[model samples]
Target: MTIFDKFDQLAAARQALEENCGDFFNMVVDDIISATEAVVNGRRMILAGSNNYLGLSFDSDCIEAACEATRQAGTGTTGSRMANGTFSGHVALEKELAQFFKRRHAIVFSTGYIANLAMLSTLVGPDEIILLDADCHASIYDGCRLGKAEIIRFRHNDINDLEKRLKRLAKRNTNILVVVEGLYSMLGDRAPLSDIAAVKRKYGAYLLVDEAHSLGVLGENGRGLAEEAGVEDEADFIVGTFSKSLGAIGGFCVSNHQQLDLVRYASRPYVFTASSSPGVIASTRKALSILHTRPELRRRLWDNANMLYQKLQDLGFSLGPEPSPIVAVRQQDKEEALAIWNALVQHGVYVNLVLPPATPDGGALLRCSMSAGHTAEQIEHIGQAFAAAHRTDQAAQTG
Candidate 1:
């Protein structure tokens, strides 16, 4: 094929998708009121798709910090972090993150994506390898490519698969860095960290846990999967995002490995990208403080999780392997999923629509990510909306 043929093929397929299932995917929102709800098409919607687990997006402290930062620091950082973008706020935020994770050091990035890119690329190289979970977020995959490492994949959360890959890696005389997500974003299932940690130790490989989804949603202190599994010390790297729990924009990496400071200089993702603005840093710092002190917030978050899990299962909708904040309602295909998604929005609810190949199975998924801010009334309304959409789809098919 010609060099441009791949682009032509992708353009054609995307056009087909637009033609057949455009409305559901290309929705426009009028206003977002809170973490759990928004106004779209002049109608109020229950926002079950947002990653704002702690629902601190609208916190007064964060907003005020952002406003103040806007006044003081202006709109953007303008230069790369290696040059002039590294602000005092960035340094303070990294220190806060390190303290939060109880690690020796931390580095902040412009985004959770860049955090993965920086860590994986800096940690793995020509003489090192990267092993990632099959269901990990796309950033981890990109990080492997950036590192130019020998990329290996294990079955999603399968300890046996991880062991198999690690065993193979041991024979190669190369350094191994195995990466996994705290929670699989699409499916909303967490990794078996304890088992994975054991296997990594057995094979003498380093482990990196991307706590993007679980940062403020798991653990007693919300330190994420490793803390919950009691294997925090075993993980060589812990990556997280401020977008979810901290209710801001930025990414961080914390580690007890004394060499983390080296990545600040060696990793292009950290050095080249503009550092997070003061507003984001300030807001995230405040949010982190609240999250640390407020254990009740975590309880409320899990309460929402349990309610959604139970209600979705009671509705006869197929769920993921286990219950967590993110819930996936299985659908037949993209067309059916789009139809259901459209029906739900028309009935006043919003959720993420997952289809092949973003979804592993050929089926589509109506993904719901709950937040602590979601009210009981809102949750009830969402359940009713799901039932309504489910009924309408069945009726349409029957007709």
Candidate 2:
């Protein structure tokens, strides 16, 4: 058989998805009206799936900054940062990121995924050990694979499991890097950072927290979970994405350790990948400033999140563990999940449809991410849409 034969199982799964839901995986957005509204397949839908948490994507200042930067610089940075890609904006943003996080050093990357790739793969070597949460993002796993490190997974958010694994490797006499996320994307549950940090300290392991989904969404200064938990100093590294709350495209790793600056020279992902464009850098910088100054945005985001979460729970839908920006409605049956997802679109709402293996519990999820841009009325309308979609799905099954 050819190498292509290996994809038969995946092809079958995709075919099944197409037959049931008209290719939800590839569903296109015909037009984007705002951060919280879009026209998809000729239907205007509330954008509950997009991870625009702070809703700065459409902010006038951010947009103007992007436009001005694009006009000043070119459309794209044609080279990697190691080469000719390091612009004034890039350097400024890195410094700002470090200052905002109150860290000694910061390294910017092409994307959030690559930031994880660069940091995780480069920090730990074959002789070293990486003890990560079982539910860490795929980027962390891929980074582990890219490196030759001995990877060990502890149970998701289980401090005891993490401690046990750390104890087992205590005598190895090699550097151990502990990796986790500030806010888990799937279930919206938070890592017990304080507990994890305590365990890390006991084991003498370096801690890396991916704050990709938590930046600008948590903590008093919007620094993420580590800051909220009062353990920011314990986290040796903090990796995050600008695509989420910052409303731009890029990733970064900031740390109090001055040695972090060396990752720029060693990380293949950083050395090979082209740097973020001028517009992205400019918009992200503006967004960061706004996130720092406007705490009301964070409050509004939480308000909307709590409202929608309570409404969904009131509707008797199974949901994630906590009420963060991410409100994942869990479903045991994949077919039922697909039906509900389609019903949602029919009711003029768009949400993310996550299926098995990708999902934390090997179930399906109709995931909704809240944004500060969404109005109270919009949140209510979304709840009504879910209710109507559920009713439609139930009627279909009975008929």
Residue 393 lDDT, candidate 1, scale 0-100: 85
Stretches of model 2 off by over 4 angstroms after superposition: none
lDDT of each: 0.87, 0.95
Q: Model 2: per-residue lDDT, tens digit, 25-143?
A: 77789999999999899889999989999999999999999999999998999999999999999999999999999998998898999999999889999899999999999999999
Candidate 1, 1-399: lDDT as tens digits:
788986997788778778866664467788988777788767888888888898899888878988898789877888778899988888888888888899989988999999998988888888778888988888988888888788989888889888987887789977898899898898889899999999999999999999999998888889999999999989999998988878888898899989889888899898888878778888888999998788887888899988988998999999888899998888766777778888888878889988787886778899998888999888888898898988998898899
User: Which pairs of residues collide in candidate 2?
Assistant: none
lDDT of 1 at 120: 87
**Cand. 2 TM to true fold:** 0.99
Q: Which candidate tops lDDT?
A: 2
> Judged by lDDT against the true structure, how good is candidate 1?
0.87
